[model samples]
Target: MNSFCNVKSVMRSMFSGFIAATVILISTYAIAETTMEKVKRTGVMTAGNSGSYPPFSVMEGKTLLGFDVDLANELGRRMGIKVKFEVIDFKGIIASLKAKRVDTLITAMTKTPGRAKQILFSVPYYDAGLGALTAKGSGILKPEDLTGKIVGVQLGSSGERYVRSTLGKKVKQVKTYDAILLAVQDLKIGRVAAVVNPIPVLRYNSKGAQLVTTPVWKRRAVGINTRKEDADLMAWIDKHLSAMKNEGFLERLDKKWFEG
Candidate 1:
């Protein structure tokens, strides 16, 4: 009878330990801070952008101005929080985001399969494509004309991917730059035969800049990026962006920046 009582006591102790462990696990999950919750608690949302990309995000005499900046400001207004910008080079922007240096990316980053594997993308906010910028008389009217010529592309961009993957072994050399403007500069000095970047950007930069533009290679969707774990934050951003589109806020921005 004493042995039976001892067994019952041991069972009770084991059961109590299991229950305590389960409670602790539940408590940990309950207290885990989501990205949206942190934003609300701190009253600020940090957004990353390649500030060199113009009409999207750019520096104007020490002030950041552009379509993306305006859009981010509007997002902050709707969230009842202030938005902070982290200007990072396009090459390292994704790494900065994964390291939590910024909460989200508004850098006109295109949605790609490889990037989607590393980060969550909000609903697409814009569409853009690759185009070549060459000297006015360079005779590089299309992608085919780029064979055996040195080309410049922004590092980590779809244009770079296309050149390396599609034009591999055809081009003499592929030069990379931190910014598209740098690539364009190289093209101007004959350092590179052509510079590839977003078609809209090429058009914007080529205006009276003595550069010739090529037809677009392909158009892709651009979306905001966040850490994969921040589903709630992603949902919040998508909801607001959808609302902005529906309300014609996005159309006005297009007219002000892209069309105007």
Candidate 2:
């Protein structure tokens, strides 16, 4: 009888220890914050962009407004932190992010090999293509049509890359501007025969110009870029983006901003 009682007591102690270990395991999985948690603990998320880029991130009367702006704020809100956006020249956005001046990039930045080497990109959120904007009656109907003509493109943009690689040699000159809107301005005034930019931008900024859909670059995707080794932050971002896509929120943004 004594031996059986001792065995029963030992079994109870072992079971209690097992239960405590399981609880600790569950707590660790549940509470161990990933990279995202560090950002949350700091109570802030900084996003970088070139606010001069219209439709995606534009500065209007001291207020930053556009699709990317909204999306950045949404991510901040979801993360339960305040979002601060840093607007600078497009060429420096990636540099600033790399230097840790900002947490991530929110501009309509394309996912390219060169960029990927510096930072990790979230799943693509938007697809952009290089398009031409020509003044009315300019006769710039297509990529070939712009041959031997001065073409304008936004500095540090995919449009600029497309022109340099595919259209620059044929064109009289490849004029680079700080913003696509500036290129469109030049296009309207005959400074260049055409302005090369993303199609969605041309859709909104082509006042006296006609958008030529014969693209120079086709279907490049845009996504938020985070610092290397930011696995938790990247995971959080992807999960939120996927949820938005599934819920039709992303579609609504495209319709409201890109289509309009």
Indicate which candidate wins on lDDT.
Answer: 1
Best TM-score among the predictions, by candidate number: 1
What is candidate 1's TM-score against the reference? 0.84
Give the lowest summed-lDDT range of ten residues in model 1.
201-210
- lDDT per model vs. reference: 0.87, 0.81
- What is the Cα-based TM-score of model 2? 0.81
Model 1 CA deviation exceeding 4 Å by range = 1-31
Candidate 1 per-residue lDDT, tens place, 141-178, comes to: 77889999999998999889888988898999999988
